[model samples]
Target: METLAFIPSPSAGEIHLGPLPLRGYALCIILGVFVAVWLGGRRWVARGGQAGTVADIAVWAVPFGLVGGRLYHVITDYQLYFGEGRNPVDAVRIWDGGLGIWGAIALGALGAWIGCRRRGIALPAYADAVAPGIVLAQALGRWGNWFNQELYGRPTDLPWALKIDPEHRPVDTPDLATYHPTFLYESLWCVGVALLVIWADRRFRLGHGRAFALYVAGYTVGRFWIEYMRVDDAHHVLGMRLNNWTAIVVFLLAVVYIVVSAKKRPGREEIVEPEAEAEPEPGTDTGGPDSADADAAPEGSSAEGSSSAKEPSEDGPGRGKPSGGKPAGDGGGDGPAGAESVAKGPEPRRKAVDGPAS
Candidate 1:
């Protein structure tokens, strides 16, 4: 008998809206992806990248990840689909809920690399920015396992035990009423890992993929222990579940990467998206025709003034003298002389108004 304190499994994992079927498993995955992109975009922008770059990259990564995850699940659990009495077409039904995180991440990285290459972006920098968000996505994705009533551990009588329907229970343990909620454990672990990554990244200034490596290391540590608890049918190696070995291997790889990357690339990337040189205004010029015209305008004005001053005046030689030899004070000859006088500091007004001493 299931206790009131135990977590209850969903009665049905799908909802039919008219003729359409909405699977909780697929909905959880989609929701997780959306949240990852939204949070990753914010982080990327904080790192000096464009706002939409994460979402744009997700367009490539999401589809590739889904395919890779499905492929991995099918390949690893081939017996579940291709076994006696099972139809081969069952492998293609992803809405039925089977996805492997290792495969998703591996192929997702490839997709992200392709996307980054196309945009001329640095993948390591982007990975660091999105590390925490990725872990958060994993946390959300674990809910899908809960909805499917899968990945739970051995029978337990704990207060927080998950109550599984008899139909969904393991054949050997059909009488079991409750089991350890490994999915919940992993989900909570992922949330903690995300917070740790964020905190560590801020505290240590982790960069150049180190932040991402830290996330992987932390996640794998939890997964290693959690994998041991899961009672799901899976291939075993050396008497250990396949995922336990994977977790151990992946954890070491992440650690080594963090160390090596720190040594090889000591500091963070200076710029996420290098600012392009600003183009000049359309109607402006940098020493072009407009500049030439500007230069010529002052020269032409000065020349016109000098020529008008020196021209044999219908007045006098000194300029505007009314046909007499005496000087004219209307300042027609003051252009060049007055400018020169002012530049030399306070002198006589006569020097500005009249011509220089012969």
Candidate 2:
């Protein structure tokens, strides 16, 4: 029988930045953000939104997400800072890489809500437009982890395990032999989530906030498994792991909320006209061709209507061609029934009426 073997080590190269060193991590993040924004903006335009709306919303979401992510990282890993006599601000040293995904998403959505309100755009529509791009952006962003050699999982030697450098290795990593590539798994999972969202949107009548909720659900499901396999030292709560529990709870909540809300409430699309429509006055016209013709009818006439203008029956009484005109057969009223009334008024001094002897 063959004994288990460790995975081969991967090499790293850092570029100089004048006085600073530029790592692949930062470049990956930058490239990811650029591509994500470009794709999102294009989608927004295709979905009948303004061209710059997604870009404008990005200004808000990016900052909010960064701050939220930093805060989450610091709050969860405060022990690391106090251990080295470092201040709370040290935890915020984003240049050194510490960001929490959950906090990023929560505050990012908040920022998106604010952006939609600022521009008076439909929040759900914009949310749907950005959903896929956000997932793919996260996928690309995780490549930074591959660079920094962080967020790896339990040790494994199944040919594709990631090899981490000794200095960058997680404290619990047995001896930097190799570990399950949790970052790669999560990144690929994110890519799958993005594709699922895009395809689901095209396939069904998903509307309102369903797409956004699906995003949360899909991401949490992936995070649940990935978080459990992670060997990185992280906070634990109440016998169960923190992030793993978070993934489960958030997934359930999103699922319940989406299902209940979608079934219970009708969507907010503008389907019906309001009750109070415009109404023209009794004697005046509202400038529509029929209304204009309505007010132009001559008095004391019957069926003498003109081709250019015709009066509406709903106009003022004693108006239009039927206004007390000579009724023909029996009744003297000037309404539609007056055609047989033979009631003459101002046409001729005698009982003169012309029109096929009616």
Candidate 3:
């Protein structure tokens, strides 16, 4: 206990402004969300999505996520909330703190789906692009509890112990003065997971929404371990209980989905350009133009042209290797005296047979 001690509390009023109040926790959250959304929008545009789509989605997603987070928090800990003279409406006081990661993601994805549908965009692509943003937002949100001096772990004498006010510590934990900084652990862990998802997304060309699933699985791995250390009272079911089991089960499912989906994707590697594709040069050999033409052509014309163009390959008169660089009977010098092949002609073959090597 004597080895190292640095106060965990920052100046209380450092985040205040006269009568108006602004908690550092809320500031961090806003900043985190802003940054995440901006980054996600940049990524979405890079991945061939329409501009402003992410922002549009955020309009819906943020509120839904917040409400879902509040509901999850309240539902899980209703006993404390309902007991004593607690008003039912106090559950709506999300600013006071309490968010559930599971609910936030579940409802947030729904919002994204709605946004994508409105924009006429594919769902998995947007999910993949925004996965990193979600990770960063979670990392920042965890700090909100940190600023509130809550969500610490069991009391400890470890070097990095967090200084908690007496009221913040769990009742059963003997040492009220010091506890683990679970917030910092989770925050840092989230950063690592975000980077992992970014790397895997670029490196392996994870298909469909596999990258997002990886994010889920990776976050779950860390959350499972970290959840074990949370001293916050929670409802328990099964051996380890609460988030621990949820994390494990969810993580396993995510992993299974990632593995199965990745395996099913075409093995030919793909790349995400993160930018709108440029218009192609006219008459270029790329199939894009021909494909567009095929799509635009009338059905009968397209079919007839396709048949005529492809018929040469199926043993047409001129299909085989040209005899002497001309069609078999074209009005060119086919001066073939016998069966032999040469760039110039069969003349060389005839001369070779007629003369000896000199």
List pairs with backbone clashes in candidate 2: 301-321, 326-343, 327-342, 327-343, 328-342, 329-340, 330-340, 330-341, 331-341
lDDT of 2 by residue, 1-358 (tens): 1216544434664557798877766666677677778878886766556667788988888889878887888888888677666676677567667788888888987888898788776677777777888888788878777777778887776677887777877665547557888888999999999888888877764667677778889999999888888887888888667888888888998899778867875453331112212334487655877655545654433223442122223344543344446433323344556553334333421123233333
Order the candidates by lDDT, highest first — what do you get? 1, 3, 2
Model 1: per-residue Cα lDDT over 42-136, one tens digit each? 98888778879899888898898888989889999999899789999999999889999999999999999999888888888889888888888
Give stretches of model 1 more than 4 Å off. Answer: 1-4, 16-20, 275-358
For residues 1-358, what per-residue lDDT tens digits would candidate 3 score against the true structure?
Answer: 3327744855451276788888867777788778778878987776666577788888877878877777888998897579788788888776667888888888877887887777566667777888888899889888888778877777777888888866666777645687788888898999998999889877877658887898999899888888788788887886675888888888888988877877787432233332334435577656666677777654434633444443334655444335555333221234453233334333333232223335
Q: Count of backbone clashes for each model?
A: 0, 9, 2
Off by over 4 Å in 3: 1-3, 11-14, 267-358
Evaluated at residue 95, the lDDT of candidate 3 is: 68
Clash pairs (backbone) in predicted model 1 = none
TM-score of each: 0.79, 0.70, 0.72
lDDT of each: 0.82, 0.70, 0.72
Better of 1 and 2 by lDDT: 1
